[model samples]
Target: MSVELEFEFEGILYSVVREFRGKAMSANAKFYKNNSLTTTGAKEVTSAIIKLTKMSKDAFMHTLFASQKELTSLSTLKNEDRKKMIRKLLGLEKIDFVEKELVEKSRELKREIEAFREVLLGEDEIKLKQEQIKESVTVKDAIAKEVLSKNEELEHIKLRERSIKKELELLSKTKEQKQKLFSELELAKNSKSSEILNQVKLSAELHQLEHKQEELKKLEPVKAEYTALQDQIKEQEKLKEFHLKKEGILKEQTLLREQYTKSKTDINTLERACEGYEEFVLNAKNLELNIAVLQESVNAKHTIENELKAEMAAEQKQIDITNAKIAKLHELGSEGACPTCTRPLIEEYDNVINSLVTVVNETHQKKINEHNKQLQNVVTQKAAFEAEAKVKEKEFSELINSIKVIESKLQDLKNAREYFVHVEQKGVKNKEELKELEQYGYDEKLHNGIKSSLTAIEAQYKHSLSLETELKRLVLVKADLENVTKKIEELKATCQNKETEFKLIIYDDVKHKHQLDEHESILKTVESKTALLNEIKV
Candidate 1:
């Protein structure tokens, strides 16, 4: 069914060779007359050839000598060919001019050939044959004319007879067609009447059902409204209950505040009492230090007095021994004897005795003076030591007072610390309780929020529930519409069936008419033959 073509032009000139389905076409110089190496030239040329054959889009012209330099050079050397090649390469040549030239040349050649053939046959020879041809032509014409006239007259009579016969056949077919149409019309009338009665009865039933559906549709909105109102009332009740719970929580908060205030006051009082106890303990410690200082001062005085008495007794014994030595020296001086022999003294012995007595008295005096000076220095040192001891005793008393105050303060501070610790502990316990109560309050509020949200959602749910019911009703309505559509489709099918039957009846009538026309034609042909025989006889 589909033909494909490939065209190739092979030769020294632009001649075309077209191939299709293994069939090849070889065109001569006439084919190359207007072709060129251009898309438009090829298209015009291909179109001209395809008018006589079946060629496809794959048609083209290929020049064999195009790529050969020697042949191209030779083709370029010819003046006319060079001009034509240049025009073709530049796409400036018109194919219409070439096609016109070819047509003119072909006409001129045909005329010239005909003139030469006429010359080859002499005029006398032609005239003799023309006369003979005229005689034969006249005889043939007369016989053919007579035969044609008879045939025409007989054909006319046969046409009239065939016309009458076909008219009779058409009348008969028309009568039968009327009877069949009347019967079909009767069936259609009866069916339409039955259908109309059924439709009336169903319409009444449908109207009653639609009326009940309308009543239900009206009641749906009212029921939905009542449900919504009920949900709102329930939510309001929950809000009231939440408010009461919040009020109770506020009361508990107030009680906790009072307890926190009382605990702080008790802690403050304990701190002040600790300060007073520290002051009392400091005064008692100072008194005990003063008593110890006085006892030490008295003991230092007794020790100094005892040491002075022992020194005075030793000095007295030494003075007594020195006086007895001075008395022995005086008695020895009164004797006046020789110092070495124990005899009565002369002038030299007296001198020696006086010197000895003077030396002993001087030694005794010096010793007494030294002892008194040393005793005075010892008494002064003892008095200074006693004063220093008194100063140290005063310092010790002050230190003891301060230490006792510190110890008493430490004890009071411990008591205060314990009291404060107890209050702080109670405060911590209260803080923990408050924390728990705050958490509980927060949880209650959160729960209330959740309940409110749930109430709101439930109200929304009730509304959506009604919408769902309406959607269900709409779905049912859609189903009814679909059923009505189906009934309409069935009626359309019946109409189509009726139309198809009518078309079949019309086709039968057309076929019978065609057969009658053929029978009339045959009868006309027979009558025409009889008329021709009668004309020949006459």
Candidate 2:
């Protein structure tokens, strides 16, 4: 028996032939691309079909040619096996496994949610804690009030103790004064005889001190003369210092005057050098303006040149297109059709060819000639503008150089003028100061004579000062003797008064200190209670 099959797959035609003679089989196949044979022989044709279809031989056999045994097995399959086979065939087994995993993950998430719910606190417990806090605050407030009352009581006790302490301190001071008075009285009694003997000797010394005082009184005129002479010497020394300062001022004035003259001369020279500053600056500005104008003209010419060149290119392109149409018309003869309209040439062929030739010569070629003329004009204008711009740029550059030189000269002039002003002001100030210094005259001869006389008088005054010091000592000693007698009487009276006052005071320092300690202990106890209350509140 022989069998032949023909089929098409993916735009390719395939053919197969098989012959079987008592289980001795032979097969041949062929495939074609676009009706052209691609592969021959069963194995080569099968491989080509498999590569084109992207399928294996077994898959191809099963998909395209199912066996009778397979059909019978499918009919006899159980429903579960059928479903399993369908799932395997459709690639849905991985989806089933993923679905099962998702279900387990969902159960785990549910459990985690329940566990989290258990760990969270309920609203009622939070309210109970808030109520406890309120009660604690109330108790703390009561304790705080008690502490305030205790503190006030402690303050009262402290004030009373402080008053008592002040009284005790005054009493102690009175006792010390009484002891001091007693000591002074004993000392005065012991020194009484010595003071009497001193009075006798002091009287004799007083007579000698009086003679020294009289001598000092006679030398007072000489001391006055010496003081006047010293004043004159100081005046002369100040005058010498002023003269030296005046000499320095004169030298400075001379230097400043020279600087002023030089600065004035430099300012004049710089001013002359910068004489045409404004004119040169204006020339530079004009040159820059001319250059800018020339540049603008050049740019305008460039724009015109570009436009003309583009127009010329378009015209030339049109001319070439027309010439091509004419050539095409000539080549088409009468039998050919028009390329653009797709019409039969017939009798209009020569007319069409003539029209194209006319367009090339009259229309496109004429436009090209006009564009060329305009382009040449633009080129000429561009060249003229560029040349003028170059000239202007050169002039601007030279003007800028001149402006820079002028500006530098002007700056020097400004600096010199400022320096001249400063020098002139300084010279005027120095001149005024020099005049002031010249007003104070000095006489060196008179100053020397007075200084010599003051030296002699100073020696005499020094001797008188010694005598005067001794006289003052004796006078102070006499006055001390009289004051001592008066102090002794006053001390006896002060002692009596202090003794009475001392007996009147009855302050008990120990008792007052004990009261203060009691108040402090009570304060500490109140503070401790307050601290405990604060802790409970927290």
Candidate 3:
């Protein structure tokens, strides 16, 4: 005879075959995941079942496949053995271990608390430390005030020292000036007689040159006419150059005008294109904000759905445990002891079983159903938010594209405006230059006539310059002699004034040095006190 069994556990399907012939038995099993073979043979299948269900083979058998003979044998066992077996079947051994660990943790926590109490400060000690801090703060404040007063005195000393130094500098300058004026007075006195003799000679020569100058003065009109003609020729040359520059400017202005007109038209077109730019940008920003908000909503919903699914899985596991406990209770009957507390279940058997049923039905299963509903709701919300986000994203993309095009046009418009202004400024500068150029009025024929007259009188003009040069030398020598006499008298007066001024300024170098030393000593004292102030602590 052969027996085959098929079952599903934790979303996987398993197939088992057992054969008995001639008092020998053979067994094989296989499991599938997603309709594909995963494990084969008895050992592999057993291992896979243990791994999937998180239970040992014995416990799995006791919980799910206990036979009548086994149940009878379990009833006949000793109390301790029966209790241990039941505890293992119901997965309550971990509870005993957890209880032991909790007791140890409690003792550890109590010891830590005692240690912490030993190190904590008492109320009286805390108050004493506070008083000490308060006294330190008072001392620090007093020191700070003293420092401030010293700084004020130090600043006053610095001001007085500066004033004294300025007076010393003025005295030094006065002494130097007096010495310089005395030297100048000595040099001028030595040169005074020689300068007087030279002045007399220059006066005699000046008379002779003055008679020659009268002769040269006759050619003054011709020379003046020659100079005027040369000036006119130079002006005419400048005018010709100006005329060429004016033509170039006119050509440039014409090009500038064309460019300005074209730029104006382009600017108008660009302005029209950018008319609704602000509104489009605003709408795009709003859409982006909405999309971000929707994305957040979708993410939140996804998180909530995941949480709900996790909660449902936890609830389902709890329900499964409760159902297992209920089944074990039924199998133990009224004579069994509780698996968790190890109490006899004679009178409270129904109560224990009903309570486990109630937990599974009213608590765990109910929570699982609620979590399912919430998960479905969250999933639906996520889908809706995602759909809305997609639509908004599309709209945002379109808006961004439009904004890019508009921005490009705006940049073009900006460039056009800049070019237009540049052109306008260039035109204005050229017009001003042209206005200045227009002031030069040139007559070529009159210029030629003036050139001929200047050429004819050039010889007489050259002859007069020789006598004029000699007369200029005589005049310069006479002026120099008069300047020397005036300078000698001025130097005498300056030397006398400087000698009196030097007598009035009294600068004692020794006293100034002592004052500087005193100021430095005060500064060092102030710095030391300031350092002490900084070091003060509360």
Candidate 4:
């Protein structure tokens, strides 16, 4: 027959089972504390079970459970509060019947409250409906009084209609006489308007004839100014070839300026790329150091693990040796002979053998537990190191990739520099042309020339075209600069991200290695204690 008992403390559940053999019973139990025992503030439960068969039919197991705290110590609390606390201390299982009763009663009360609330709502609805009916009755009475007053007003309106019909007949006769008088008045007004219009046209013609001489005198100076502007236009035509040559030199200057700016940008980008590569290289070196440390820590864990394995094997060997010795003793004792000497086995030897075996088993069990704990720590350290190494290895690969991209861009920059040399040759020849123009003394003064005004305007148009072309080129160059700036920003962001990730990997790897060292030290202490505990003296 087997019986199981359960205990609960601070929300943690524990159970124990005992088996009875034949008609005899034994009470043997082992307890394991929670893994969070040291960290959490929960109390450990210590329980005792006693089974006694006062009667053969009534065998019962009596269990008494206690904790690190006592409910009786709550003497200063109020009576009800102390009782409530005592109930919580009893825990969920201890007060199962009472809690079920409370839950059922609470549900019944909740249903009763809902029924009462429903009755109150029904009464409120009835009151609201009665108010609405009374208001409808009052509205009906008001509408009835308004209808009666409107009937009296309809009688007065009929009497006024008869008097209006007589007045309308008198107005129709007077309206005919008034219309004839209006027709005569309109004829006189149209005749007077025609006479006034004829007078206004005659007066306007006389005024224009009087002003003709003054207008001719004002035009004489304006005609002379037009003649002078035409002369200035003709003189400016002599410089058309000079202006065209100057336009070419200005175009070359603009192109040279753009190329120079591009060269400066290329130099800056190369410098930054070099710096980024060097920084990443430095980071790679640091990663190597971290990897070395990690490897060393792994080696240390392996050494500890091997030593633990050896210790366990030695314990097993000791157990095997002890068992062999016991077997020999048992065989010799039964045969009534001693294997070491030609004498009978001593009684004292039996007692000594039992004590030795008990000590060996106890020590072996304790050492094995300590060894297992240390071995687990070493395994965990190795696992953590390997995981960090994986990420570090991934980042190192990314760093190499980044370096390759930068190198490719550097090659592109070198090609651009060769293109820049070709542009420089063109710029130098244009600069020489600009010097020649300077020596000949270019003049910008415009003189009036009516004979060549059209040609001068053509020269000005060509200059305007050159100005517009330069403006368009400037806008394109600005857009290109923005694009280059954007590319630089993107490259900067990528380099920064790679550097940060690589550094983080190295930093984390170092931290993991440091933790492994700490674990190794802890294992070393455990090993020392296990060795001391398992030591056997001859």
Candidate 5:
């Protein structure tokens, strides 16, 4: 809660109040000395309050002027801007309503004070001076009291000064911003686009074009293959080049005749050597047949030897068994028993067992003699067959070497004959080609030049293919660049067009700026009202 300070100053009504919240303080001042307490007078009070609240002077002045343009309902305003015009219609003291007429009224009050002073003096002017001296003391005391009481109000004045300084600084900065922005606005109107916008657009176009160029790599496809094909064709033409020279034809013909004669001689020689080769080949075949016969005989003899050895082994085993049986029979005679039957041996049984043993021994010896003789004969036959097979192999090897030598000589002759034939044939063809060239008068220089360019022509063909692809890509690129350039042109024309007074964006910016100014004015109004409320609260 706050208390209002109402006082009379220079015969005019004045109200000043102070308020505080925490460390901050505010106050408001209203001069009601000019007019009666009517709704019309409330506006004057509001203007004074605006002044005392330390808001932007120019802004509030403008607002005050605008608000005072016409008087309207005060009750419609917010409580922060409360304005009541209470009339002093029934008053006991006939108190005066002081206003701008105070200057005129003050003259009257001065005359009256002078007349009353004269009346109170009652005699000597010196006595009046003495009374004036006493009154000066009281006046000094009153001044001291007023000064002591106005300390809070002085603080409010200081607060107002600080606020006013802040608003002044804000106003100055706003003025600078206005100058700078308006200059920029003029430049924007002159230019096609802002620097940033132009840079962005150009950079985008550069990037797109550069990216396309990078992506479209200019390369020839299979240059080496194309060149090789041309060289092959050139080589084929060179083989027919002999056909292009008539003077060289006679010389080539002479050479071809010689080559043909040599080929016939070589062919005859090869044929003779081939006859010898045939004889050697026949001998090798005969030796191979002999070797086959000998091998078969040797294989049969080896089989006989194996059979004889097996028989001899069987006879030897029988002899060993008979010997063991004879020894066992001797033991039986000594023991006088037949062990198998577990009975005493008779004399006739001993003779029978001995005779059986002797017969078995005689049979084993006879088979062994026959087996040994057969084995010896098989060994002799095998040796003879092996020796014959070896002689056949040696004869076959000699015949093979002789046949290989004869065949090599025949192959050499054949190769020489083939070379001669090839030379003769090529010469004949070249002779006919030369006759044809003589009829046509072929240019050696031109042919050589064309031959030299074979590889280059192939390379150019491949390069041309790459160029064709690149040209196609460039065509599309040109179209795209043209389109983009046209768009940029159109935009530039639109931007530079004198058809309108200002660009829409500039107008919008200006409009927003004015709106901000209006907001600032409203802010001052709100602030002043707040200050007044704060004072009233105080």
Candidate 6:
């Protein structure tokens, strides 16, 4: 089964969307980029990311392009009610639809920022960036899946086309040869003269003609067989068509089943993601509460600092040692560290040290003031870093999400690909089975075998024609021989008649001469008798 098609692909490429019984399943891309950079790795990863993001965003733009389903769930509340509920849940303003849009944009920005960070950040920073990367990976996976699906389909089509083309070429060659043979047969008949030969004087020629006539009689059954073969060939062709159609129907059914399975899987995955979204909401709420409590503690501590100054100075000194220990403890959270560093100082040496301690504390305070200003600058820098990190995280997350979508889509495509492969395999099996079906009613091979038998019959028929021609030639030759025999008989009769006439003429001449001789003898006797009688009378 083959189809001829002209494809125009300069502007648009075509591909098949496949299914294995119709279930979605992941497939890997044929080509992968490793240590490869495009757009100088400087043009900011190309607008392709933007295009894909927009495509995804447009799919749910009506829902404010929300990545999570939670926003849609919050949409039902009145503005003030929503504001109060939002503040209670996550310490935020109301769930304005506009806010959803802004949040989505922020997420996109976060993803972009995260990607930049991933590229720039040292190895130690990667642990902090992992969550962002996961998100980005998901998005990348989605696009990869879409591309892979199309490629697989294209490959299948190409393979199928090549196979069909080969079969078509073979058929064409066979058909052409058959036509050529028929043409040559026609040419042989036209060129060969059907004239009968003249009778000859040779007995060997007559014997040869007799043998040829016998050979002609032997060819009659062969001609009948040839005609039968031709009929069988026609019957076989019809069977082939029927089997092919059956194969096509089976292939189509295989594809349908795969599609159904993939849809079910997609629905299940969507449900699972919705549950995860609920968990995210809970975590966001807890973080908001913690931030609020921390702000209050900072305010209370600042207010009480002056009242406890002298006592606080001693306590502060103790607390500073503890603070240093705590920092060291954090640094050594997973390993061994200095334990004596946290112990408070005590003894008589304190008097000499107190003066030195005052000078040191005063200088330390001045240094602290300068450090606080520097810390403020660091804090500002950190905020900017955080902003950038958030954007990167958001962008990366989006990419990861997209990758997940791609992975899921890839799964669907894989399922589709598998389904098609199954369909194709089934089709091939059906064809094979059809061949195996010796049941004359369904088997194409059986029909072809019958056709071959018919062709043999046709060849026999042609032989019969040859025999008939020989028979005709023999009949013409026999008639010429009969005519020659009749002419020879006529010539023999004419020769016998001439011999009889010649005998008659000779006999007549002999009888006439004898009569004349007798007459002459009697006249001579009379004359002698008369002379004797006259002498006696005297």
What lDDT, from 0 to 1, does candidate 3 have?
0.79
Per-residue lDDT of 404-474 in model 6, one digit per residue for the tens? Answer: 66556556655655665665566566657656644545665676677666655565566556656555656
lDDT of each: 0.59, 0.77, 0.79, 0.61, 0.63, 0.53
> Model 2 lDDT vs. the true structure?
0.77
Q: Which candidate comes out best when scored by lDDT?
A: 3
Q: How many clashes does each candidate structure show, in the order listed?
A: 5, 0, 0, 9, 3, 73
Worst ten in a row by lDDT for model 5: 84-93
Looking at model 5, residue 113 earns an lDDT score of: 90
Give the C-alpha miss distance for residue 487 in model 3, angstroms.
Answer: 25
In model 5, pairs of residues that clash are 2-538, 3-538, 243-433
| Cα-based lDDT at residue 100, candidate 2 | 96
**For model 4, which pairs clash?**
230-449, 230-450, 231-448, 231-449, 232-447, 232-448, 232-449, 233-449, 234-449
Lowest lDDT block of 10, candidate 4: 38-47
Better of 3 and 5 by TM-score: 3
lDDT of 3 by residue, 290-373 (tens): 998999999899889888888888888888887888888888899998977989999999888887888788998888888888
Model 5, range 436-464, lDDT digits (tens) per residue?
66644345666566666664556556655
Give the 10-residue window scoring lowest on summed lDDT in candidate 1. Answer: 58-67
Candidate 1, 402-509: lDDT as tens digits: 656656656766665666566556656655654554433234555566566556556545655555555555555556655655565565566566656655653356
In candidate 2, the residue pairs with backbone N, CA or C atoms under 3 Å apart (3 or more residues apart, or in different chains) clash, namely none
Q: Tell me the spans in candidate 6 whose CA falls farther than 4 Å from its real position.
A: 1-211, 214-229, 240-538
- lDDT (0-100) at residue 432 of candidate 5? 69
- Model 3 sits at a Cα RMSD from the real structure of 44.9
Which portions of model 5 show Cα errors greater than 4 Å?
Answer: 1-265, 332-335, 338-362, 404-418, 439-526, 534-538
> Per-residue lDDT tens digits of candidate 2, residues 174-292?
55766676676566555655555666676777778878888888999988887888888888899988988888999998899889888888987887888888888888888888888
On TM-score, the leading prediction is 2
Positional deviation of residue 53's Cα in model 4 after best superposition, in angstroms: 99
Order of candidate numbers by lDDT, starting with the best: 3, 2, 5, 4, 1, 6
